[model samples]
Target: MKTVVITGGAGFLGSHLCDLFIKKGHRVICLDNFLTGKKSNVAALERDRHFVLVEQDVSRPFRVAGSVHLILHFASPASPVDYYRYPLETMRVGSMGTHHALELARAKKAVFLMASTSEIYGDPLVHPQTEEYWGNVNPIGPRSVYDETKRFSEALTMAYRRAYLLDTKIVRIFNTYGPRMRIDDGRAIPNFIAQALKNKPLTIYGNGMQTRSFCYVSDLVEGIYRLSRSRYHDPVNLGNPREMTLKELIVFIRTMTNSKSKIVYKPLPKDDPKQRQPDISRARVLLKWQPRVAVEEGLPTTIAWFRDRI
Candidate 1:
């Protein structure tokens, strides 16, 4: 069986990755600092012989047993409220944390898959951002700390691949939602859902005209697993092609929960994308991956999950 190490293995995406690796008959070493990770996410895996959790900060160098077959780096504050509130910590983890993961990958001679975000697209001018787009980003803006750090993380990975001949891959993830999402966050899906469930006014920023593509977490994880097993070394976009506006999304959530909440408008946050979607042609062509779960199918499950929690 292959041995795999996943950073941030207790967070929403990381916890899911740990489960996937362990289920596929791989020894999973989950490294997380619990900065934003929840213990409940990994509680189910504690009984599994193949699953091990280690609370380690990736800012420092650490060692793991056995030769790791793959390293999934998903350790960073992903939400806007997170990055904005803890900008330095976010930057450190993205920069220093990624450096440590790359070192671990090199030590184990493993394939390292860096979880880059579509945030690198930064208010994308392109309709559906492809892997080739350079992106229109503000270097000194509020989102720059996160955006530039990811850009650096990608650059560092590419350099390591070229210089050290290490096997590395990158997936620029777009909007993903499902169980275990942070209810306090400002992501439209969770934000709207949480507000609606609590019988609070649903807040819409900037006329709610901004659009985003939503990918179910299951589909995203499937794509990540496929990319990790493949030989492609460059970045690939993994996201749902289905797009919708904020207003339409709020209405959908209101209908989904059968809540009596009215829509309230607020000024758009700085650096909010006008339009964002992924061009997954590369993922489709290379990894043979396309999102299977529709937003309709994914949303109900999420709504139920949140309903149970709050």
Candidate 2:
């Protein structure tokens, strides 16, 4: 079995990956500083023989003993709330953290995978953003901390691949949601679900016309796994192509939750993308992957998790 190391392994997506790899009989070392990641997320695997949880910040230089066949760099404050609250930390992880991860991969001659985001496309000028379209990002904006850092991470990964010939891959993740999502993470799915469950008004920012494509966590994870095994080194977009406006999502959640939550309006956040969608033609052709879980099917599962937690 291969030995895999996942940075940020105690976080939402990272914890799930740890479970997946361990289930497949691979030894997994999960590294996290817990700035945003919760120990409870990986609590179930504490006794597993193949799982090793390491509390270390990737931004700082760290080393591992023995052979490491794979390294997945997922260390970063992913949510808007988290990054906005810790902008400098976000920048450091995206840069120094990524650097350390790359060095580890190079040393072990392992496959390096970076978990990038669709935010790199930043208020995209192109509709249904494809992997080829360069993004339109405002460097001085509030959201740049997350967006630009991801962009830099991708660039740095590519540079390592070219200079050191280190096997590297980057997957640009779109809006993804599922169980273990913190209620106050400040993403749309959890925010709407929490507000609706609490019988509070669902807040819609800026007329709620801004569009986003949501991919269930399982679907996204499958796609990332496929990309990791494939030879294609260029960035791949992994997300459901179904697009919807914020207003529509709120209505759907209210109806699904059977709540009396009224809609409220707020000024839109600066640099928030007006339209967000992924053109996953490449993923479909290359990875032989497409999102199987529709929002209708996925919502209930997510709601049940939140219901139990809340």
Candidate 3:
């Protein structure tokens, strides 16, 4: 069995990757600093023979005794609240941390897979952002701190692939949601869920017309897995292509949670994308992957996880 090391493995997506690797009969090593991640996410897997959890930051060079066949570099502050709260940390993880992971991958002679985001295509002028489209990103904006870092990360990944002949896979993930997402994380879906659960008004920005395509975490994880195992070296977009307005999403969440919360409009945040939908034609053709979990089916599953009012 191959040994897989997943940095930031105690997080929402990282923990899920850990579970997937362990379930596949591989020796899994999970590393995290616990800045935004929780221990409970990986607590259940602590006792498993195939699972090993390491509480450490990836910005610093890390090592393991045995050879790791694969490394999933997922360390970063992904959410708005997180980036706003820890901008410097986000920059460090995306820049230095990604470099450190690359170094480790070289040491272990493993395939390096990065969990990049669709935010690289900031406030996209392109209708459906594709892997080939050069993004329209602002360097001075607040979102630049995260967006630019990811862009640099991708650049470096490509450089490593050519310079070092490293096997690298980069997947540009879209807005993914599911259970284990912290209620206070301050993303749209979780924010709506938390507000509805508290019987409070759901917040919508700029008249709630802005649109984003949400991919279920399970579907995203599956796509990432497929890309990592495939020969696709360029970044692949893995997300649901179904677009929905913020207002429509809030309404759907209300129905799913059976909440009586009214909608409240707020000033839009800095550099919030007006439209975002991934063009997954590449993923479909190369990886044979398409998101199957529609928003309708995903909402109830997520609601059930948070139904007890945490």
Q: RMSD per prediction, one decimal?
A: 0.8, 0.6, 0.8
If ranked by lDDT, best first, what sequence of candidates would result? Answer: 2, 1, 3
* TM-score per candidate, chains pooled: 0.99, 0.99, 0.98
By TM-score, highest first, what's the ranking? 2, 1, 3
lDDT of 2 by residue, 1-310 (tens): 9999999999999998988888888999999999999999999999998899999999999999999999999989999999999999999999999999999999999999999999999989999899999899999799999999899999999999999999999999999999998999999999999999999999998999899999999998889888889999999999989999999999999999999999999999898889999999999999999999999999999999999988
Please, what are the lDDT tens digits per residue for candidate 1 over residues 1-310? 9988999999999999998888888999999998877889999999999999999999778888778889999999889988898899889999999999999999889999999999998988887898899999999999998999999999999999999999999999999999998888668899999999988999999998889999999999989999999999999999999999999999999999999999999898888889998999999999889999998899999999999989
In model 2, the Cα lDDT at residue 299 comes to 92
Compared with the true structure, what per-residue lDDT tens digits does model 3 show for residues 42-150? 9999999999988888888777888899999998988989988999999999999999999988888899999889999888999899988888888889999899999
Worst 10 residues of 2 by lDDT: 219-228
Query: What local distance difference test score does each model get?
Result: 0.92, 0.94, 0.91
Local error of candidate 2 at 199, Å?
0.4
Evaluate model 3: give its TM-score: 0.98
The better candidate by lDDT, 1 or 2, is: 2
Query: Alpha-carbon error at 97 in model 2, in Å?
Result: 0.2
* Model 2 segments more than 4 A misplaced: none
